[model samples]
Target: MKQSTALTIATGVAAAAIGGLFFYARATRPPVINPDVPEPAKPVELARYLGKWFELARHENRFEKGLDGVTAEYALEDERIRITNSGCQSGPKGERSSASGRAIVVDEGTNAKLKVSFFGPFYVGDYWVLDHGDDYDWSIVGEPSGRYLWVLSREAKPAAAAVEALLQRVEALGYDRWALRITRQG
Candidate 1:
């Protein structure tokens, strides 16, 4: 009886240790932001190509520091999505940064999901459309797991009411309301 009790306790401890490790791995792993395939965002109904968009909010990351008023331009390059992001920093000289990347759609027609690669080797991340306005003035963008978020608008600054409506739609997608970082634009 003593030996059996000892063995059970040891097993329980081992299991607990394994569970802890698993949880830690999940919490510490770098964020992955891509769909399974290259899917194009739908509602091409919205004339996305050649539209100017301002980043209203985004998830915090190392790459963007003191960045604000960033604008992105999307265009088609031989059937692929080309992206150019530019923003300015606060300083005497007003420092600026720009990055260019390419994206591809995993789903065609109306699905509105994509995989974007910012690095030369093309590491990809999901670019899902959570919501879009009828006039295509604003949109809420997110990933499958809700880890990354972005709210974009055709104007440099979206209206307050529009932003609130967009947030409501984003909440329906299963993400914590507090997890979002609202971006400031000039």
Candidate 2:
């Protein structure tokens, strides 16, 4: 009886130690954005692309955690594109949060890729247009590193059919649909 009890206690302790290590490893590991990134689908017309856009979905990013009703507005300022990203923290009427940034065309011929800077010239990130609707109703934005992605629509609350179509396109582009968090529109 004594030997059996000792064995049971040892097994329990070993299991707990292993579980703790597993959780710690998970917490420290870097997030995997996407592995198999593809090429840009087509060129983007800057003029038509400049306007208010509603975020339909995005990867679970640390900066925008717990945010919903997100929106991004763009305007042309000289040679740069102005960016304004806003979102709600809680309910529909939650306090509003916003950040301003600027973007410059990386390629003049295509105008499909941009470098966005939120903190002056020192900070920048890739903003590549993976694909878009022919009529510019929706757009899929990603980076070369595949660490981030965003789906934007011209309408605040687009039709369900259109959203589904965009999601399918996103998946086809080697993005994981489960990693996308649908945003609530106001």
Candidate 3:
């Protein structure tokens, strides 16, 4: 009887220790810092913005790791935007993987901020258009949390000058330009 009681106490102590560690980790985790960066002055025209956009550069994330020839296609469906993202796993000619999601414009006036959901209505993520070209040839997508950033273009391969300029613009917005991984397109 005494041995069983001691075992029970040990188990309780172990559980409490684990609970304490989890609480400590949660409390000490760094929060996302969003700077006072300006959104696009003009609203995005859904019609002009539709179609395919090739990934030029992006802040490294696990979702698209080991991906190449990444492209995101947008299509208008009623009042929502359908998002189709595809990429090659190994290289430009590697195995292809795709994910589909839907986005709703958060503000009708600007059409710059959107809430996208891939897993039904429960899980949603932010999709903000920070900047874009007048002709919709290029765009910069980011979140208000400043955790993710992507540089996209209409062309599969954009010119060096254009990419340099885009990187400069991203840097000006207080993002870590060095964290951007130039996507491989073939």
The regions of model 1 sitting more than 4 angstroms off are 1-42, 91-93
lDDT of 2 at 41: 91
How many clashes in each structure? 12, 0, 0
Q: What is the TM-score of each candidate against the true structure?
A: 0.70, 0.82, 0.81
Q: Which residue segments of model 2 deviate by more than 4 Å?
A: 1-30
Write the residue-wise lDDT of candidate 3 on 1-186 in tens digits: 999999999999999999998898566533433355557556898889899999999876767877999999999997799999999988889989899999999988989889999889977988988888999999999887676789999999888999999899888777777878889998
Give the Cα lDDT of each candidate: 0.70, 0.88, 0.86
Q: How accurate is candidate 3 locally (lDDT)?
A: 0.86
Best by TM-score: 2
Residue pairs with colliding backbones in model 2 are none
> What's the CA error at residue 43 for candidate 1, in Å?
3.8
Lowest lDDT block of 10, candidate 1: 33-42
- What is candidate 1's CA lDDT for residue 124? 82
Better of 2 and 3 by lDDT: 2
Off by over 4 Å in 3: 1-37
Span of ten consecutive residues with least summed lDDT in model 2: 25-34
Q: State which candidate, 1 or 3, has the greater lDDT.
A: 3
